[model samples]
Target: MANVTVVDHPLVQHKLSIMRNRETSTGGFRRLLREISLLLGYEVTRDLELTTMRIETPIEPMDAPTLEGKKLVFASVLRAGNGLLEGLLDLVPAARVAHVGLYRDHDTLQAVEYFFKAPTDLHDRLVIVVDPMLATANSAIMAIDKLKERGATNLRFLCLLAAPEGIKRFTEAHPDVPVFTAAIDRQLNELGYIIPGLGDAGDRMYGTK
Candidate 1:
């Protein structure tokens, strides 16, 4: 895909395989999600702009490279997105956080927003939207729309798995926003679930039915 980046790192693929196994316990699933997310986060933030700063090392003073501009924002799309958010935070502890609460209405497969809270200056920072799955893409689309309305100009979407249908819909909806994922699955099932995906991320992570 032109705008999509699939992180095919060995560690990522290994963790994702474990997560896809139905026999994996909830605690195991949760732990793997957090672990793989760190790897995925590394790829997503690879091109972050850097600036040079003068700092004294143990040996001598020199210009050190540091992230430029304002701290980036991680916009998590509701409950499931929190899985990826936790690990990304571990990587960038100083990054700003945003929460966009959206749940899929199973009957219509539409997203419904229940909550939203973000920094007031979204226009000035890079916003990376994180979610475990992008099956129907309804929730991801709506979450980004809300963030744009709030003045988020530069944005990206990150996920553990994505269906071809969902990727097409997401790219068409927001062409400028790049997508980062661990894997692009075969397709979406009739019920809007990613085929071969790790089941419902929220249910698996929380040990709920």
Candidate 2:
């Protein structure tokens, strides 16, 4: 609760509702996610630091605001996270990208990484980790763990939907990492899926059931 923000804009909520319907096609789902992510992106990046620099305009030269430091980095968590990545990039086109591939060990409910590639100088840039679902937080925790190991200090976790159980465990595991989501659902089902959620983000987004 200390660092979590739920984006409740009307457009986000309306698009989320459409995504919840089981009949929504894969293309439709992906489109809605793209739309909703832009709104969420705005909320999460609202406090970015800005610096003034002299610039020339049509009428005259004046001091204009620009983002400080190097371009931001967005670490997307595998397939599902990719859904949110594009929209966020649209918001910050100059941002760098990182990809992390992970899967859950069904028996242990742990996350296993198969691929990891991030940009250099992670320590100097703000890293925003994106994932569509924060179910049990195991994947989110592990993903952030990997990023921290690579010298990421300023980090944030962004998800489309989150479970209370996942949020509790995530915050406890990484208290320093603030979280942002479009909505916090009621609970996680027995299979660790968010209740009343839009369903498996990867499957719905890519039609890869």
Candidate 3:
């Protein structure tokens, strides 16, 4: 089974607490989301491959190590995912950006993809899929499925918060991909929202509601 890493960093926990409060102002919520996303991005890139090369420094010759292989592709799962993408890009400015949009049908609860754009050689790059919440796992699963269809084999999923049911479903569906989240909440409600989650991530991020 794929591993689901819940970041226990104090900074992540603190920002998440502020985001969860009902009284948190719109500005605060947005800022906190960006900050938390940056922190989570740090953890997600911990195992990035590195290679060493000899370099001549001002003082002396030295062997320096740098990242190896093709650059990463930060694939955002549409509107809500944009909230996480901004911070992640701050850390990996060289990474390519891709967008995939999926909407859940209110009646059928099925994931419907509306948009997708990715690098031509997706299989060679490390693809990190970002979204603010993992609720029912329908959208995340569908988004990843689309990536696989496009030849994306090296992939990871990042989220600010996740529900247990969503995590289970995601791991079961893609055991090869790992998941990183700031926190794991309880379960999804009937409406397919993570229980005690920060409401609708898209709505909160954009102050839509």
List TM-score per model, in order. 0.99, 0.98, 0.96
Considering TM-score, which of the candidate structures 1 and 3 is the better prediction for this target? 1
Q: Give the poorly placed runs of model 1, Cα more than 4 Å off.
A: none
RMSD of 2: 0.8
Model 3 lDDT per residue over 1-209, tens place? 23999999998998999999988988888888888888999899999999989999999999899999999999999989998999998888999998999888978778899999999999999999999998889999999999999999999999999999999999999988899998899888888889898898888888896
Best-matching candidate per TM-score: 1
Task: Identify the leading candidate in terms of lDDT.
Answer: 1
Candidate 1 clashes between residue pairs 3 or more apart in a chain or in different chains: none
- Writing each residue's lDDT as its tens digit, candidate 1 over 72-171 gives 9999998999999999999999999999999999899999999999999999999999999999999999999999999999999999999999999999
**Candidate lDDT (C-alpha), each:** 0.96, 0.93, 0.91
Clashes by residue pair, model 2: none
Ranking of candidates on lDDT, top first: 1, 2, 3
Please say which candidate is ahead in TM-score: 1 or 2. Answer: 1
Clash number for each model:
0, 0, 0
By lDDT, is 1 or 3 better?
Answer: 1
Q: Of the candidates numbered 2 and 3, which has the greater lDDT value?
A: 2
Model 2 misplacement above 4 A? none
